[model samples]
Target: MNLNLYIMLKSSTIALLILLSGLFISCKQSKGLTVSNMKKHHIESNIKGLGDDTILVYYVPLSKMGEDYEPIQDTIFSKNDRFAYDTPSNEPILLYLFSKKGEFTRKSGHPYRPDEKHIVALVKPTDQLNITGELKQYYLDYQVQGSAFNEQYTQVRKNYIEATSEAVSIELKLDALMAINGDTTEINDLFQKRNAVNSAGRNAHLEYIKNNPDKDLAAYYLTRQPWEIFGKYYNELSLNVRNGIFKNALESKIIKYKKYTQVQEAELKIKEGESAPDFELRSLSGNFSLNAVKTKYIVLDFWGSWCPPCTKGFPKMKAYYSKYKESIEFIGIDCNETEEKWRKAVLNYDLPWPQVINKLDIDDDVSVKYGIKAYPTKFIIDKDKKILAKFIGKDDSFYQKLDELMATK
Candidate 1:
C-alpha cells in the first residue's frame, strides 16, 4: 500500500522526533509468556460509523535489532462499532494500530495517500485502555483513556507536535523555494524560523522532564532527549523508579551512553593531525591492515548497503577513486549489512578500490576505535597516517578537500 509514501505524509513528525531522539532504546527477544511472567493488557477501540473494517495490532520492540525487524502483529475485525484485543508481554511495550481499509489522499491530489489509518500509543501490563475516535480523523482526533502512561504520553506528544509543526511547515516552504530557485532572503528567513522552532521544542521537552521526574512517561521522553540533557537528568531518578519495568530499558541506554561518552573522548585524542588508529579486518581477498596499505593517502569510508545515502553517494566516490587510484587508496568498510547484500552493492557500484566488511556487528571494534557515529562517514588520512579530514555524507566540499590534498603532491 505504498507504505513509504504513507509514512512520509502521516508520520513525518513522529519520524523526526525519533531521529532527533538518537539511539537509546534496544529491543530484546521476548521471553515466552508463562504463568509467573505473564502480564496481559486489554485495548477496546471504538471507531464511530465503522463496520466490517479490519484492525491490526502491532507490537514494536524497543531494541536496536528490533528497529529494523518486523513487529509482532495480530488482527481483529471490528464488530458492533467496536474492536478489542489482548496483548501479552513480560514488560511494558509499544503498540501500533492500523485500519486495513482507510486511506486518504492529500488535498493536492498527490498520487500516494497518507496511511491516516493508524495511531500509536504506549501500553503496560494489566492496563485496560479505551480508545474512541472517528475513522475519518484517525490519529489526530483520537482519545485514549485508562492508562496513565498512555495519557501522559499523549500530552507530551501534543507539545512536541505543536512545537515542531512550524519548523516542518517552514522546511516544506524552503523545499518549494529551492525547487523554483526562489529568493535567498525568503530561504534564509525560513531557515532561521526552523532553527528557532527546534530550539523551542527542546526547551519544552526539558521542562516536561523536570516537572514529571517520577513518571514512566518522563523516562520514555528521556530516551528521546539529546545525550547532553539525558546525561544531566538521568541520574536524578530514584533507584526504585529506574528499576521499574517500563524504565528498565534505560539501563541499556545508560551502558550505550557510557560507550558513546568513551567514543567521544577517544575522538578528541585522534582529531585531525593525530595518527589514525590501526586495525586489521578481513576483506574479500585477504586480511587488510591500515598500516599495510601502499598509498600516499587513504580514505576510510564507513557505510552499509542498507543505507540509501551511502549507495547514492557511491558514484561520486567511485569517480574520485578512479581519478586518485595511483596516489590514494579508498577502502569501503561495510557495516551492518548481510554478506550477500554487501557483495551485491560492491559489484553494483563497480567499486574498484579495496573493500572490507565489518563482518561482526554494527558497532564493531574498528568503528568504536575511530569513534564512527553515522553511515557514510569518511576519514582522509595522509602518508604518515595522520587524519587530514573527516566528513559525513557527500558534498562538493568533500571533493574540494580531497582535490586540495591531492594537489599538494
Candidate 2:
C-alpha cells in the first residue's frame, strides 16, 4: 500500500522528538536505564483507522510514569503529541496521536488542575479498533519507508563529514583574506542574495549539481557559483546549504552572510574615543539628546520589548540606574518590537532609564555607526564620550566589567 510522504515525515519527526525528550529527562536520573532496557521498556503499538492519515498508538508510559497517570488533556495532551509520566514530572513524555487537528480536543476531567497524578488510557487490540487490515498495511509500509529514509539521511551526512570539516577551514581562509585586504566588498557580494534573480540563480546552480553530480555540465555549472570562484567552496558551505562542494562555493558567493545585524535605529555611531554622534530622539516624555546629560556617564542599551532576556536584564539595569542616577545615565533604544509590547515591558519591568524607539533596523546607517549587532548590547560611555567597555548577555564577567567601568578613572 501507499501513504502520504508528509505524514511519514511528520511521524518521523515526532519519533525523533520523543528520543530527545527521553534523553533530556534521563540525564537528571543517577541510575538511568541502559539503552537496551530503555528500548524494551518503551511500548509502541500502532493502529491504523478508516482515516488512513491518523495512526493510533497504544503504549504504557515510560519507567518513571505509572499506568494510572491522568495525562493533562487540554493544555498538555494531544493525540499526535508525546507524553511521558514515568519520567520526571517536569519532563513529560511525548504521546503522539494521529489526528486531523494535530491537537487533542479532550479536556481533562480535572480542568486546569495540573497536580493530578493518576490517569488511564484505553488501547484495544489491533483487530478490535474497527480499522481494516488494508489501512494497517499502509502504516506498515510507511514505517518501513520512514526507517529507510532516516538511515539514508544519516549515511549521507556521515559521507559528507570530511566536507563539513571544511567549514572551519573556510572561516580561517576568510579571516586571512580579510586580514590581507582591508576591503571585504568583493567577498561580501558572493553571499548576498538580495534580489530574486540572484536567489533563483543560486538555488538552480546548487540543485542541478546536487541531483545530477555525475554530469560534466553539472560540474561546470557548479564551478561558476560564487564559493567556487573564491576557491573556498570545499571548506566553507554547510550541508543544508546544498550540493556539497558546489553549494559551499555558492554560499561563499553570497554577501554579508556573517555581517552583524543592527536591532534598532537611532543608535549612536561615535566610537569609544570619538565624539558621540549628536541626535534628537523622541519619547512619550519628550525629545532629548546626549548634550543635555553631558556631565554624566551613559550606558546605551539596545533591546526589543519582545525579547525575554531583554526583559530579565531590565531589573538589574534598573538597580544600577537607581544607584547611579546622580552621576550616570541610561539611554535605551527599543528595537524590532511593537509599541504596545515595548510600552508594556517598560511598565512591567519598571524601567527607570530614558527610553526611546527606533523604527529603523539596527543595520541601518545609524546602527552601523555604533557597530551594534545583537540584542541587549550595552556600551558604557564616559562623560568625555569615550567608550569604556562593551557587554553582551547577562554573565558574571559582564557585571564585573560594568562595576570596573563605574568604579571611576
Candidate 3:
C-alpha cells in the first residue's frame, strides 16, 4: 500500500519531459494563431480532475517588463485560509512557471517579448498534468496537508482564543524546534547546522511516513515540500541570505553559502582597487595563472561546465574577441568546474579566449576576486591596470557598455 511508488512513478522525469515537450510543440503551431498587442494576457490552467485542490503560481518581474502587466484584480489562489481570496477577482489565475526553472519553448514563444522588454511567467496547476495538479491529495493525510491545510493551520494557530488553537500551537512549536537555528559563530557554521537539522527533520518525517505508509505525507514531503518551501521564500530568502552576510550568521552549515561569501569577498577586494590578487588554479589542461591574463584590457569571465547560460554566452564572447583581438584580450576563468567538463565545455563552446582554471583548490577565487556575485560578471580595464567598469550580468546592456567603452578608447 505504499503510495510513494505511485507518486514516484507519476513524477518521473520522463513524464515532465513529455508534458513540457507537448507544451513546447503546442506553442509552436503556427496555424492556431492569436495575435495581440495587449498590455497583459490572462492565463489559467484548464486543470480538470481536481475540482478545488490545485496550487497555482504566476510570476512577473517588474524591473524587466515595466508596469504593463499588472493584474487588473487581486490574485491569491489557495482555497482554505482566513486570508483566502475574498473577491473572485483576487484569485491569482496566472500561474508563473518561469520563476522556478527553465523550460523548452518554441523560439516564437520566447520568454521575453521584443517590444515589451520584460520577462514574466504565468503558471497554474492543471488537471491536464496529473502530477502538479493533484499535489494537494498527496498531502491530505499528513498532519501538514497541502497549501490549504497550511493556510488553515496558520489561522488556527493565530486565533489562540478559538477552538483547536492548542493543537495548532503545538505544531508550530514543533516546527520551530525542528527548523534550523539562525544564530551561530559564522554564517558558514550556521548553514551547516541548519542543513543538518533539516536533514534530521526530513529523516524523522520520512520515518513517520514509513509507519503510516498509506498516508500521503511521504509524497508531500518528498515531492511538494520543496516547491512549498522554495515558492514561499524563494525571493525573500535569496535576498536575505545574499544580504545576510553582513546582517548575521546562519545557525546551520551551508557549503554553498560559504562558497558564495568567499566569492563575494574576492570580488570586493578587486573592486577596492587592490591588486588583482594572484591565484594558481589547476584545470584539465594544466596549472594556469589568474593574474597572467593581465593585458591592455582583460575580460575575465566566470563560468562552469554545467551552466546552460554559460554555453549560450560563450559563443557571443568568442565572436566579440575575434572582432577586437588587437584592442582587447579575453580570459576564461572556470568556476566550480570538473576538469573533464571544463575541457568539453571549452571545445563545445568554441571559446577563443585564453582559458585558465583555479588550481589553488580555492573556492572559485576568480569569482571571489572580481566581486562576481553571479555568473558572467565582466570587467573592463584600462592599460594602467585600473578597472574601467564592471558589468553585473550578461545582458545586452553589458555588451552595449563594452562597445561604448571600446569605442571611447
Estimated TM-score for each candidate: 0.72, 0.41, 0.41
Evaluated at residue 197, the lDDT of candidate 3 is 40
RMSD, model 2, all Cα superposed? 18.7
TM-score of 2: 0.41
Alpha-carbon deviation at 134 in model 3, angstroms? 9.1
If ranked by lDDT, best first, what sequence of candidates would result? 1, 2, 3
Q: Which stretches of candidate 2 lie over 4 Å from their true place?
A: 1-272, 361-366
Each prediction's number of clashing residue pairs: 5, 38, 34
Per-residue accuracy of model 2 over 1-409 as CA lDDT, tens digit each = 0110111111222333343222221112223222232442232323233232222222322322212233332212222222222232232232323322222111222111000011112221211111111122112111211222222323332343333333323433444555566356744642242232234434555665566445433433443444333243323333443443233323433322222222123234444566665555666488777677778888787777645566677767788778778877888887655678777777877787788776443234333556555566777777887777776555446567667766854
Candidate 1 residues 185-303, lDDT tens each?
Answer: 88888888888877765677678778878776677667666667778999876666676644545765565566567667777786899999998888888888999975568989888
RMSD (CA, Å), each prediction: 7.6, 18.7, 19.0
Which regions in candidate 1 have their CA more than 4 angstroms from the true location? Answer: 1-41, 47-57, 61-68, 73-83, 88-91, 98-118, 133-139, 155-205, 338-340, 359-364, 401-408
Which one wins on lDDT? 1
**Candidate 1 TM-score over all chains jointly:** 0.72
Model 2 / residue 237 / CA error / Å: 18
